[model samples]
Target chain A: MPKVTIDNITIDVEEGTTILNAARKIGGRIVPPAMCYYSKLKGSGGKCRTCLVKVAQSSAKDPRPMPKLVASCSTPVQDGMVVQNLTSPEVAEARKGIVEFLLLNHPLDCPVCDQAGECDLQDLSFGYGMEETATEDDRREFPVIDIGDKIKLHMNRCILCYRCVYVADQLTDKRLHGILYRGDVSEISTFIGNAVTNDFSGNMIDVCPVGALTDKTARFKSRVWFLKPMDAHRACGKCPGKVAIWMFGNEIYRVTGRKDQFGEVEEFICNECRFEKKEPGDWVIEGPRHIKRQSVISANHYEEMKKQSIIDPIAGEMNKQE
Target chain B: MKSLTNRSKVVSNKQMTFWERIYFPAILNGMRITFGHLFRRKATVQYPEATREFSDIYRGKHVLKRDDEGRERCTSCGLCAVACPAEAITMVSAERKPGEEHLYREEKYAAVYEINMLRCIFCGDCEEACPKEAIFLTKELVKSEYQREKFIYGKDELVESPDPAKRVDVSKRQTKEVLEFKKDKRYKHNK
Candidate 1:
């Protein structure tokens, strides 16, 4: 185990653990915001530089600070290494610049985007971005395209985080899509009309940081804030059946993998569980899914009374389903 | 228990004086004051023929605005619906199909928008929440109807007319500072 100090808090972790993961272990505000890094996926970091942190001390032996702010997602921890995330004003200023670059070509279509309320990019820009964009240049535009019949791809809003590419490469059997171009005109596209279809293709929509990819079945139906998220599961052979089902009244609006506090989906669900299971009877309900109080999705949602109930009626129902 | 403060008062059943028992002078005094009001200016005007002046910022009826190009400005983002304390606003948004760009300003448009006028407190939070400068509470009052169902205003009743001359003016409700802010070209929302 190696000892690391992040934002004045000390923690001991395994030698190969990255700075972002070490901060995540401590939890709360100390954790750097990551747009591209997915803990479950390999080689998913260092693309989006939102998680840059200042290294005050390299290690116990060499007490020299790194020359520049390093990407915390890819930088491994050293024994007695001292890191500063929120405590360093240099990192904060650099992060704002990163946010500006990430949003440089991103369209201002959040009002129409399906992933507005729960979007990680939306939260990141809101916290770090300037009120007015300094650039007057026109943003790159692309007509929306359908990836298979289940997902819609809006290339205009992609930050090129490459998380979706990792999902397609790692989870699915045959990867059909990846970053197509280079430099300023790069885009994520399937080789024209060749739909990216597989058992795990739907997981790409969940991993996308922005509204670049969205569930086509739930498109324009309703906003995320208007729906109630319920923890749900069903007996499936392909993958873990656990998922979160967004409902409007009694009708299931959409189904997605249950994301944790850091917005990472721990278990990648199959397309059958993500797209096809859209009925209340398709799975057993397990009460309301917990949402952070600050999130817009939790505006009118409350679960205090549900927590105090004595009877375990839903538990019996879950057993019956199993 | 001791009283919390010194403001408490007691009631008494005391005998009345001769002047109070008579009640004749008291009645005459009341009549004199009542007659004095007959020669003074009236407090109210007749509602049907004569109307009183309303404040410039009076918030009565809501109007869904149209852009200068005559396209509907509401994207149906649900901010107004969530900001509504009374929860009177509800809407269903649909993606703008090809060739329908002239009908809506954004990619999403309110396919169906309704407001329960009876339940609305007219607090103008929806007006404050509209980011597109779409919804505004105008000086025009909501007309009374015979049935409750008629009070639920649909998009037909809420959206302003497309004709330039017939458009409802709500400039009076917006402050000068807000108008100045909206004029800045740096913000994408202004553009």
Candidate 2:
């Protein structure tokens, strides 16, 4: 175990522990922006550069690169390593640049997007992005692509994050998705232009940080901001694990990987648990029945109902006497 | 009601005054209001020929990234999928073959990837989720489709060439280590 001081707070961690884990252990106030860190998966997948941090006195031999900002998700903790999360202009610039770079291709459809309220990009843009963009005319043009029956591919909104493919392959033990091309032109796709038909396919919609991927059934139906989420613990219909169901307006719209049941560091919700099965009354809001005034109090209707209600009963004699 | 002040019950048919019938003052007032608007600057923008400047942080279309060697940066890791709140992304991974090394930089490559353009909300979580910087949401916003199927982009459409300014030249030692690691026995299953 080695002791590392992150922002003046010293903490002891294992040899292979990354700076993020150390920061977590020390209860540091610094925000670790992790985009690809699935607690349930093996790989840290330091794909997003949002979690860069400055470290003082990095290594004994390499002293020139001291206080060099590194991806906190990938940098392992070293003895006497002083990590500074805030107060670094370079980290701020990097984050701003990353946010700017990300927004270069993102579509401005939040007004009609289903994930407007719960989107991570919305939050990050509000926090890190600049007030305006530089190149406005050089926008990418693409038509909307539909993969299959359940999923609708909105390439305009996709940021090319590979979390869906990762979950399908690494965590769910299913190999259903992959990226097809190289930089700035790459996208997530499937074989033979087939739609994603996996049972756990709906989970991808929930895990997507942006609105690039969404459930076809839930699309254009309700904005995420309008949804009132209720917490309910129930066993997965397909898997044995107890999953968290998010109910909106007394109807279950979707289910997600539970962070509470699975530790914060071990956030693994299987594909079976993520996809929501359409039940008979899942979306039906049961309110008081609307009885038409014309159909109210029909004697023939009551008489026929009374005759069918008495099979072998004293009620039959009472009805006959009446 | 009858008028009481008539001297001989005279029914007078009055003619209009010159100013009242001509209505020149009212017409002049109307012309003044109309002429005022002519001098004002027009607020309408000539679209297609002229465009509004987008904010520096405006979210728009997506961009697939490439590495320095023009290789696909996506390792099919699927972190973007996890980060996506909409679950619009789907992919299939394939082991890179010997000849296809130039196409992809990693042993594991994405074979099939699709994003439903109709279902996407454009939040950029996929950009944040990508570990390899393979996916990005560019400022481009001209996404229109005549057919829904054409909107769904494949790998050939998504991957982009890496920017020369942003590319970092890997050291010879690092490149050797990567090649060695690729040949290592642990990666045998992947290859």
Q: What is the DockQ of each candidate?
A: 0.75, 0.01
What tens digits encode model 2's per-residue C-alpha lDDT throughout A232-321?
334545644444444444565665444321123124444544554434243222222111122211111212234543675676544433
lDDT of each: 0.91, 0.61
Summarize candidate 2's per-residue lDDT along B35-121 as a digit string, tens digits. 999999888789889888875545566666676577777666555655566767766656566798888876457787777666678
Best by TM-score: 1
Candidate No. with top lDDT: 1
Going through the candidates in order, what fraction of the true interface contacts does each contain? 0.83, 0.00
Score candidate 2 by lDDT: 0.61
lDDT per residue (tens digit) for residues B57-76 in model 1: 88889999998889999999
- Looking at model 1, residue A277 earns an lDDT score of 88
- Name model 2 segments beyond 4 Å from true: A59-68, A259-322, B1-191
